[model samples]
Target: MTTLAEEVLAGSRLALARLLTLIENEDPQGEAALDRLFPHSGRAHWIGVTGSPGAGKSSLVNRLAQAFRRPADGSPPRTVAIVAVDPSSPFTGGALLGDRVRMRDLSGDPGVFIRSMASRGALGGLARTTPAVVQALDSAGFDIILIETVGAGQSEVEIARLAHTVLVVEAPGMGDDIQAIKAGILEIADILVLNKADLPGAENALRTLRAMLELGRPPHEETAESLPVVWRPPLVPTIATQNEGIAELLGHIQAHAAYLRQSGGWQVRDRSRLQTQLEELLQTALLKRWRSSLPEGQYQQILTDLQARRISPYQALHSLLGEPPLPQSIQRGSTALFNA
Candidate 1:
């Protein structure tokens, strides 16, 4: 029997879905399949779409996917994959919104695949398994993967590290222009999209965004040869509900992709993302291995002392690591008196 990874490589959508589920559940089988599939990954362009709540991000993403499937410049259409992340239900940890409902128009397309995921309390907008899911999609031969983040303002900059190009969507009349000035998320945007452009105050919103971009850029130097290639983020106004401005937006996205390739930003982003994933996996593995090696109930005993205030948190951590506790005067922020 062909392995699931082999099936996915042969364009089996059902196998792909099953593998995604296994990966999300942290199944060992999924890890093995992913390892088998990793050699085929990294070919797709990862695009991150993020912004404030109710900014029409879903609509924009929907239109962008269509554009990818039918390029306006008469270029061959590319396969598209979408990973839409929704907020998790606080009680059940289930996705609150089914993004597939909003993207029903693309459901019949053979070249497009959409996956909805729950944030599951993972911070910074994406689900915990999103990058792994993206890798699966990439290995399956998708040309572009759009990752739509949960609309969490400010704390949503994680996508900057994952995607080759990042689109920060903002809507007019939503006070997003003001929030753009205050939010660190704007710094990570490769393109600033003013979605809902047909709404009132659109021009004002556009002007505000342009001004902010100007302020963020470094001043021009007289020596032109000394400067490096810089991509100034363009502001594209779109009425996504009507599919207006989508072609132009796609043009900008394509341009950004070309720039990344020319400037080596593509490889840089890939390296950084893989490094982060490696470090996180290493940390988790080390913690689990260490915890399993400890004497039964010793970890719990440390926690008990920690909660009772009999030992400071630092002391508890040192004890768990089999390290000698530092002197109270030497420990940073050490105020508790240790009784042990």
Candidate 2:
């Protein structure tokens, strides 16, 4: 069979979609494809858009794409890739797939590629293979890639760890829901966007956010000695539906990207993300090997023994492995796999 990577490199839309599906399913082929493409990656600028449901993140992303369509002087027109994630309906295990509907105009543009992904109950607000898919798109020469989350609760913070710039969207009348966002989402935002800014209570919400940000700031260094530390982040307001303030938003994103690179934060963040990916792959492989090495018919007996209180689950697991779990420090070492 012709591989998805080959098709994607050849600019096949259907092949691109199939590759995304394979990665979403975490198929073994997906890993192989990623390995084949990794050398071609790192060219795209990744932007993550996330917030509460109904925050208009999809619209915001579409506007962002339009803004990024034309690259600066001497540079080629930018190609954008969008990954929109939606929660799967429990009854059917399928996403509503509504983001694409709002972005239909860009669908026909060869420069823009959009893919909708169902969360499929992946923890941390991303599909397990999302990073790999992003890498593929980056390698395929997309200049800008945007990730839109399902807008679930706090776990969506995971998006921050992936993107070079993160825009946290909010709308009017979220009320205490904004407070809920403060608990986790605030820290992750490189830019705070008040979407649906035309709505009632929008100004009030913006004022509240400003106050919250001010309150979160650290006291002046010269201030009369002892005070608690606080952190303040930049915020912006936008009506993404009307495309208002989008240019400014893009400017901020560019500025933030510059800041990350200048301050060395870009390399640090990228290294951390790569380390996390490596650890996850290693852990998955280790678990699979451990599971496959078990004697046939041994699983049921282990489960039964643990359930019946004949032995602790830990003890049963040890018996299955024929060894105790490796210590944390050793697991960080080169010999960890042999120990496992």
Candidate 3:
């Protein structure tokens, strides 16, 4: 195991920060450390929050962190980790990293760690390295990891692949009450939050969500009788700016956690997430190997042919890939010379 990973597991915040920076920089050491640390993870409950830009996601996340950070009921203090994903600058590939600005109350709290990540033009509302970083935080002993998506949109629902409980937030006046439905975000939520509940259209938004749920969700009897036991999502209204209904929202989250445990949803979710990671890693590895092994100009000639309309794209691809292609996995950052 890397020294930085050792220190991170030993509760060294500085070492943890350094390891995260190494990951952000795409250092090999960071990947090695993550591979080592992966076994120690899987304990933290990941919560993904997604909404439109003006939906008050940051404020809600700040409030959630504060509520979790303040220990109560004889339980030991709960450590929280927040990964706030922001849009990246196209030219520089850097994020503003300003999500923490609204969370000043949590800055002095030793139990909370907030990281702002740039999307880096990755689709699906997350940085490519988000899962690894989340694993890092989980292994370092955070209790709740909040992943705030790059904002609500058609593609933003990808957070469903990463989090145990997904909160689809909406605020009145941001758009039509049915926008969540239109975007397909409502279907993916484990919990729906109507933020800025004090706004004029709050009731209308709630009604719309309720109507959608009634129309889209399966019957409660069917959910209860299902083999794995399905849990219905609850819509909780909140004024995040004033911290209203945070406790109720937390209660819903806790209930979801309990439900996941009872129904074995945790293992199922972990397996799904792992499969996704494996597929993506395999694809990347294969692409890298293909690029490195391709004869120089062979790819470009295909491109040139297509550009000159001498061949169709599919025909060009077929020519590039001969019959009986190799079936193998990546080994040590290189293509295995033999069957693997």
Candidate 4:
């Protein structure tokens, strides 16, 4: 069999899906594949779509894909990858796998690569290995990548750290939902998409958003002689299921991309994302090593002792590794345990 990396580089869809599965499972080979592919990444534009579960994020992403499918010239269409994250069953630990069902029409399209990932207990709305999967898609030459989160409340904020642009989707008659969104998602959104805008309360929602925009001051102030400018984010209304406003959404995305480039925020965002990813990788590796090196049954004993209050967590941790607590003087000179 061709190695997963070779097949992925050669644009084999099966290999791409299989590789994504391995990475999601955190297989050893997946780590090796990421190591091989990292140098080849950094080309694609990553867009993240997230909101409450009923906001139609998948439908919006599907429409966005349709809008971007055709290249400007008569040349072949640019490849696009969609990573749709779904909630896994608590009992079975398997995804409900509904994203693929929603996106069935685009599954067979050679120009679009769609993969549904199970959250698999990742604390944030994203999958634990989502960044790795995105890297694989990026290195595989996908021109654009869309990541859809599990729609799990505020934790979806993490998507902003990974995506170049984040679309926060909302719908009609969701005032409380919109308030909840403001707590976290609002800060991350590059664009706010009010989907299902044909509904009765859509206008009210739009007005609410506009009022919210007016409350916040712009990041920068204009000189006295200059025009008083508002840095209001683009709020676009869309009926995604009907394919209305998708073209405009694409235009907004392109415009934002241009803005990022011109404002120098693109490189800064990219660097910050890469740095966060590096730290996450280090954390994963350290946890794996720590888990593997622990003596059998030691963790269970620690837990039992913790519950009984016979041992404090700090003392138990030090005891498990046969280390004494360092003196304050020594601690100042030495690196922290996390660094160690």
Candidate 5:
């Protein structure tokens, strides 16, 4: 283990922040530390919050975090981690990372750690390094880790695959009734939230979401034979700024967490997350080796052929794979492009 990793496990917030920065920058050493720290992970509950841009998700997260840290809940004080993703430049693919300003109130609490990350133009409403960042926090002994996505509309359901529990927030008056509760976003919601519930048209939004949920699944039926039980997501209304429904929202979150543990879903989700992490790392390593082995001029010619549709991609791959290895001076793998 690196000295930094030891410090992070020892509860040094500065060391944890430094490690996260390394992962954010895609430093190779960051990956090595994650590998060393993997055994210490699988301890934190991963929660993801996603919604449209104006859904009051920031306030909602802040309130929920405070509730998690509250000692009056009959449990000891627990540590929490927050990762807020914000959009960055399209040209440079950098992030503005202004989400921290909204969460500044949570600063300076030794039990809370909030990180603002740039989306870096990733289409999933999350930074590419988010999983690694979550792993870092998990290894550092955080109890609950909440991730707030960029809220870039329906295509941003990447949280479903990344988090153990996903809270999908919606605000009234954002769109037409039917258009507001699109199937794409609803399918991924483990808990649906109707934020801004004090605003006009809140009832209509609630009704629309309720009706949509009714139409979404077949209700449980008593059968002659025993059947499996399934979880149905409940929609909770909240006015975050006023702290309305915050306790109820958290109650649902805790119920979902308990359900996951009781149903063995936690282990299943952890396996899925680890599989994704392994595949991503393997893809990076393979791509790096492939680029390193390419004998210069040969790759550009392939790109030109691909652009002109003069040759199929499979044909190009086959040709490249059939080619001899890079010259000995290159010091890369000495085998052929795709074969020994």
Candidate 6:
């Protein structure tokens, strides 16, 4: 009998979809399959497309998918898997799946697979199960995996930790000149895309982005001891609606990939991403173990004491951990307060 992981490895699309659903739901079977598929992972190029709402990220992803599937340079087409993370519907807890609708053209292409995911109230513009899903897609033989984040703003820079290359898309007339400085999102960009370039104020937006890049550029003096070489984010203007600049953007993506390989940054990023996943898993497991070990109603009692101001939160934590008791002064106050 062929296992689901074996089926996915053999290019079974139905098995792949079922595996992804199980992974998103955090099923144990999915984890077992992922364990088996782990060795086959890490072969795909992870590109993240992220930006504020209304920046045309979905259209950009659609165009990028097409470009990869049918390369202009006459290179053999690459298999592309797109993970579009959408804001969850509050009422139904389901993804709106707007990207699936916009990317209708790529539906019939066997070389392309698109999955839409709900954000599920997770912060940083990505769902909690995203890394696992990407891993599954990677092991399933996709050459390029594009993770399109939920419409996000400044603080949603978590994509940087996951993607080998991150494209921070922008648009004209968004007052992005100021937002660029205030928002840390631009800092993570390997490529800065000014989409909707056909719109008015496009030039101004482009110029502002260029200036920002220049300002953030690291010194590259060779004669003297210079700072480590940094990959400055290239600002590319595009009208995603028209499919213009898609080729150039694709070139930039390829260039970044090549640079990472040459500079050994590829391994660095992969290690960092793995480390993050490990730490997150460790934290979750530890919390779960700690919760299960607690005496029945002990945590609730602490919360009651905390509410009544009988014990400070720090003391409560100590009590929970079986740490040293609070000072006599504090204990007296706690008792009196509790009695009162």
lDDT (C-alpha, whole model) for all candidates: 0.90, 0.80, 0.86, 0.82, 0.87, 0.92
Tens-digit lDDT track for model 6 on 91-125?
Answer: 88876678888898898899999998989989899
1-340, model 4: which lDDT tens digit per residue? Answer: 8677888898888887888888988899988887888888998999999988798999998888877786343565667899998988888887787877677668668899888888888866888888889989999999999999988865578898899888989888766535743556666778889999999988888888766655553776554544223334688999998988887888888777776766666798899999999999799789989989998998899999999999878878898788987677776666566486
**Model 1 regions lying over 4 Å from their true place:** 176-178, 219-228, 328-340
Q: Deviation in angstroms for 262 in model 5? A: 0.5
State the displacement of the C-alpha of residue 318, model 5, in Å, after optimal TM-score superposition.
Answer: 4.0
Query: What is the descending lDDT order?
Result: 6, 1, 5, 3, 4, 2
Assess every candidate by TM-score: 0.93, 0.83, 0.90, 0.85, 0.89, 0.93
What are the RMSDs of all candidates, in order? Answer: 3.3, 7.9, 8.1, 6.0, 7.7, 3.9
Compute the lDDT for candidate 5. 0.87
Alpha-carbon shift of residue 13 in model 2 (angstroms): 3.6
Pairwise TM-score winner, candidates 1 and 4:
1
Q: Model 3 — which ten-residue stretch has the worst lDDT?
A: 324-333
State the lDDT of candidate 1 residue by residue for 1-340, as single tens digits.
Answer: 8999999999999999999999989999999999999999989999999999999999899999999888878899999999999999889877766788789889889999998898999999998888899999999999999999999988798898789999999888767665768878889999999999988999999999899999988654433444337778889999999999999999889989987787777898899999988887899899999889999999899888999999989779889888997865765444344532
In model 1, the Cα lDDT at residue 102 comes to 80
Better of 3 and 4 by TM-score: 3
Candidate 2, 1-340: lDDT as tens digits: 8677787787887877777777878788877887787888876788999888888988999888887885443456678999888888878887787888889768668899888887887877777777888888887889889999888855578887788888888788886645744557766877888888899998888888777677666654432333212223577888887878887888788877776666666787788888888999899899999789889989999899989999877778778879876566864684666777
Residue pairs with backbone overlap in model 5 = none
**Colliding pairs, model 6:** none
lDDT per residue, candidate 3, 30-54, as tens digits? 9988988889999999999997788
In TM-score terms, candidate 6 sits at: 0.93
Q: How many clashing pairs per prediction, in order?
A: 0, 0, 1, 0, 0, 0
Better of 4 and 5 by TM-score: 5
Residue 167 of model 3: what lDDT? 95
Model 2 C-alpha RMSD vs. true structure (Å) is 7.9
